[model samples]
Target: MIEAAFRVLKVLEESDTPISGEEISKQLDISRSAVWKHVQELRSYGYEIASSRAEGYDLIASPDRLLPYEIEKHLKTWHIGRYFDYHDSVPSTIGVAKELCRNKNPSELHGMVVIAEEQSGGVGRLGRAWYSPRGGIWTTIILRPAIPVDHVFMVTMAASIAVARTIRKFCGAGALIKWPNDIYIGNEKIAGVLQEISAEAETVNYCLLSIGIDANISEEQLPSGVKTPITTLFRACGAPVDRARFLAQLLREFETRYREIESGEYHTIAREWKSLSLTLDKRVKITTPRKSFEGEAIDIDEYGALIVRKDNGKVERVFSGDCTPA
Candidate 1:
């Protein structure tokens, strides 16, 4: 069903006029009833297929779901998203990616993306629960980076820039990256990134970069007692967004930034990140495992550490922490 259905879909997609069931069966080497069954299966997945005894079948419209076929149709990158795994619901995309890395070859899994429509056990930074209801983007990309382990944090930095730029281009929102790896629209949070790595002392085995976005989810879908101000693209744009297209743009942007890092262009990422900084020059609370303090986020270093100037006039570099703007 998987291979033949995709083959049938590809033929229909490439055709300008409606394709007859008999013609599709002859081209695909399957029975006419098989073609009809696959078309029904595709329609159940939200593909609008028009059927008539005279005109045969025509592709009317594709759904907004993040199906592999939908993403692959619009994706233009070489390796990023070249191999995709989509699920209607899962505990976590990060969890699924970790299992794939453990069982399969890490190198082969590079540039692969795992997506879930809903996550029941999604976890964000510091093991906090991430609310991943339907109508959002919950995905994790597997990478076998050639860069040093010290520079691995830059992957998240690259992802941050990608998401920010994609939102600006696709949704027309003036999105900015909050220090570390969070996307914000003005003062409200719209997206966040969580990165996990399996690394040795100096080499990285594989990296799982997870990204979550509240694309079409409404404010009412979010649970109460949330700590920070949050927002969705639907609210910001006054309508639902096409999630599949946005994801393809993000993967392309990320692949470009990732290539830069692999080629040792740290300054390029640093400069772009600073220009899009939402926390710079603002008073923020930085809480690390050791201590907490208030400071102004002046800048970020080449390796993506937040350079903070404390109230005591002392400067410190924080590699990882929870940054909250006051």
Candidate 2:
């Protein structure tokens, strides 16, 4: 039924004038009543359809939701986001991606992106609550990568670079990467990347990269009492951004960087990440499951670990942790 609706929408989109239900029925080989039903379905998904006795139906507008159909319109990636799933609301895209991995072959599910308009139970590093409201891009990409287990952090690095590039090129925002995996504009965070990996011995079985971006959210939409300052593209740019276009560009950038790592171009990833670094040469606080310390964030090693010089004149390499500016 949704497929028929998509076909109906296609016909309507291609036509300059209104298309009659009878013409649509004949083109799609469905009944006129079915055409009307499909048109209603499109309307429910935030499409504005105008119906007239003499003029038939006309498409007036489309909503800002990250519907799969909408994303596919602007998508140009070869693999990443090629297979897309969208939800109006979910507990988390991560959970959905995990479920899909269990049910389907990991190879077949590679580069599949599961997106949600909102998340009720979204989480970030260290099991912190991620404020996933509407007007944000909350998604998880399932990957069956061919890279070694120790280099999995490159996935997060590639993602952060993709996000920063997309925001800069598409939205005209000055975005930069914070150490580990966060995108920042000025002192506030605008996006974050979290990775969950499955591996055995030295081979990575699969990886789930969950990315959340505050695209079109407003100040009122932001929750109170958050430890770090969080800003949205809308607030930053003084207007709302096109979420579909931004996401499409981001996926393309990510696929490009992911391909680099697959070909053993770790230095390319490291170079790009360093050029866009906001954490380097800054005082920072690194918190792990066991300990927390303040130091000067020096550089990122080849494996994506952060190298920091502690106040006591000792250098520490952090593999996975929460990094914030001190």
Candidate 3:
């Protein structure tokens, strides 16, 4: 019904004058009664539909809802958001992506996105809870990359670079990427990425790349016990940003980097990721599932693994772990 109303409104928008019920029915191949029902539904959703005896219906303005049409109007990416599924509220977009991947064909679902205005059960890295308020950007990208399983970490690195670059471009602040997936502005975390992949023994089938940004969320909205310093765009700039425009820019940047990953030009992305990384060249402590080690963060290798030189003059390459400044 919502789609039908939008179709009617779009027709009215393209027309030079108002459209009648009969004309709308003929154009949309629907019954006149159906058109009336849809028009009423549109009104209920806060669409100002100017109705007159002579002029059947006209759309004056739309509600402040984050509809897909509004998002597509501003979305400029080629592939990142070509197909979008949105919800006013959801438990988690990553969960939605997982459910979709189970029944739906992954190869047919290229560059699809799942977004939620508010997340009730968002999970972060290491199974940590993510406090996702209504004002933040919470979304996940679904991709089927034909890369080796060992190189899957590059996807997280690519997304981290994209988010950091986008924040720096818009906020004009010095944004840096902490090792693995955190984005920071002067020691306060502003964004993070979570990557989940399903694979066979040697090939990857699909990857869910989830990125959450503290766009307009307030400090008061945050939960207690968050020890790390955190900041939002509103707090840093003293105003709310246009969320739709920022999201569009972020998707565009991500699509560009994703293409680089697909083309096996990972070293190029690795170089840029290293440059924006705050962990490189710092004395750091890394904790894996087994043990912890402290060393000088020397560099990240071509495959996006962190290389650390220990005080004992031995070097270690860590593929996945929790890293912190020592």
lDDT of 3 by residue, 223-288 (tens): 777878889987766787777777877888888888888889888989999889899989999999
Cα lDDT tens digits for candidate 1, 225-248: 888789998988888988988899
By TM-score, rank the candidates, best first.
2, 1, 3
By lDDT, the better pick of 1 and 2 is 2
- Give the TM-score of each candidate: 0.96, 0.97, 0.88
Best-matching candidate per TM-score: 2
Candidate 2, RMSD to the unseen true structure: 1.2
Q: By lDDT, is 2 or 3 better?
A: 2
| Ordering by lDDT | 2, 1, 3
Candidate 2 residues lying further than 4 Å off, grouped into runs, are: none
Stronger candidate by lDDT (1 vs 3)? 1
lDDT of 2 by residue, 1-326 (tens): 77779999999999899989999999989999999999999999999999998999999998998988888899988899879888999999999999998998889999999999999999998788999999999999999999988898999999999999988886677899998889999889999999999889998878999999998998899999988899998987778888988898899999999999999999999999999999999999999889999999999987999999999999999998888878
TM-score of candidate 2 to 2 decimals: 0.97
lDDT of each: 0.92, 0.92, 0.86
* Prediction-by-prediction clash tally: 0, 0, 0
Q: Which candidate number has the best lDDT?
A: 2
